[model samples]
Target: MLDQIPLEHILLLSAALFTIGILAVITKRHAVVVLMGIELIFNAANLNLVAFSRHDPVLMQGQMFSLFVILVAAAEAAVALAIVLRVYQHFKTANLNQIVTKEG
Candidate 1:
């Protein structure tokens, strides 16, 4: 039943997802939420790359690069979360504004 939709519609959805990610990054102050926003941004970018690759199947570089990006993003998220946890253990708070205070 979903095959009737055009390719342009999929592209538009990707654009909307990207916009939502930007909005999340701008509106959220919590570290975890911001990280989630970054993930959304990465996913949106990957979706766009895949969409472009769909038209030119022979040139697989974009898709390969996007896969690497996804892997790097995963690693970044893991390391970032670990750092955030350490900071929380030391400071007793996860709020970015509080962590940036002079007290350290």
Candidate 2:
């Protein structure tokens, strides 16, 4: 089924998703939303990796790298959420601007 779709289309979709993720990360002030954006970015990369892997005949290196990327993303999310929780506990808010502007 995937073979029916052209590689260019897949790449375009991935690029669009990545761009949206970038916008969300840059524009959102909430930590959770930013984290979600980061996940979106990861997913976009995963899509590209999988799409490219379909064309390869000898080795599935792209799929392997995608798996590694997923593993790293999961670990990163766990650590980032822990840090966000600590920041919220210390600052009493998840707003990035407010947290930064407040005096320690």
Candidate 3:
């Protein structure tokens, strides 16, 4: 017998993951934590895309799009991390709250 779990289950999981990411982005003061939160949100979106792709073999657009999203996320992370490193070197702090002053 085919597994009968409803599509709602996947959507629920995606919602939970998205909520966690939003919470992380809002509550964490560290720049890295915010970056991680952003990544989590992207991952959740990718999960949804893959789940949708599974039901249709002829049209794998969702899967292909997810792959592109993953690649973009990776590149974004690399560039963001490098920028964070530079900021830290100049400011000696990784806290997002501390870096917002115009003086710096």
Candidate 4:
């Protein structure tokens, strides 16, 4: 079944996901939305990794790398969200455009 689908199709799907993620990251002002976009980007890369590793049933290097990427992404999300929470607590807003630092 998987053999019937061409590699181009999988690549196209991943590319589309990556594009959407980029657009979200570029256009959205909300910190959570930015984080979601980052997650989407990570997922897109994971999809590409799985698609390319589908052929290598023996070694599965791409799959292993994808797992590592997932771990890294998870850690990034935890730390980033913590920072965002702190920023929100200080500013009382999650909007990136509205966040400003006060300097004396």
Error of 3 at 2 (Å): 10
Query: For model 1, how does the per-residue alpha-carbon lDDT over 1-104 read when each residue is reduced to its tens digit?
Result: 22356668878888888888898889877888888888988998887787777767788877998999999999999999999899899888877778865774
lDDT of 4 by residue, 51-94 (tens): 98888878989989999999999999999999999999999999
- Residue pairs that clash (backbone atoms under 3 angstroms), model 4: none
Could you tell me which 10 consecutive residues in candidate 3 have the lowest summed lDDT?
1-10
> Which residue pairs collide in model 2, if any?
none
* Each prediction's whole-model lDDT (CA): 0.83, 0.94, 0.89, 0.94
Could you give the C-alpha RMSD of every candidate to the true structure, in order shown? Answer: 2.6, 1.8, 2.4, 1.3
lDDT of 2 by residue, 6-104 (tens): 999999999999998999999999999999999999999999998999989469899999999999999999999999999999999998988865478
Measured against the true structure, the TM-scores of the candidates, in listed sequence, are: 0.86, 0.91, 0.88, 0.92
Q: Give the runs in model 3 whose Cα sits over 4 Å from its true position.
A: 1-5, 100-104
lDDT of 4 at 60: 88
Error of 1 at 71 (Å): 0.9
TM-score-better candidate, 2 vs 3? 2
Give per-candidate clash totals. 0, 0, 0, 0
Candidate 1 vs. true structure, TM-score: 0.86
How many clashing pairs in candidate 2?
A: 0
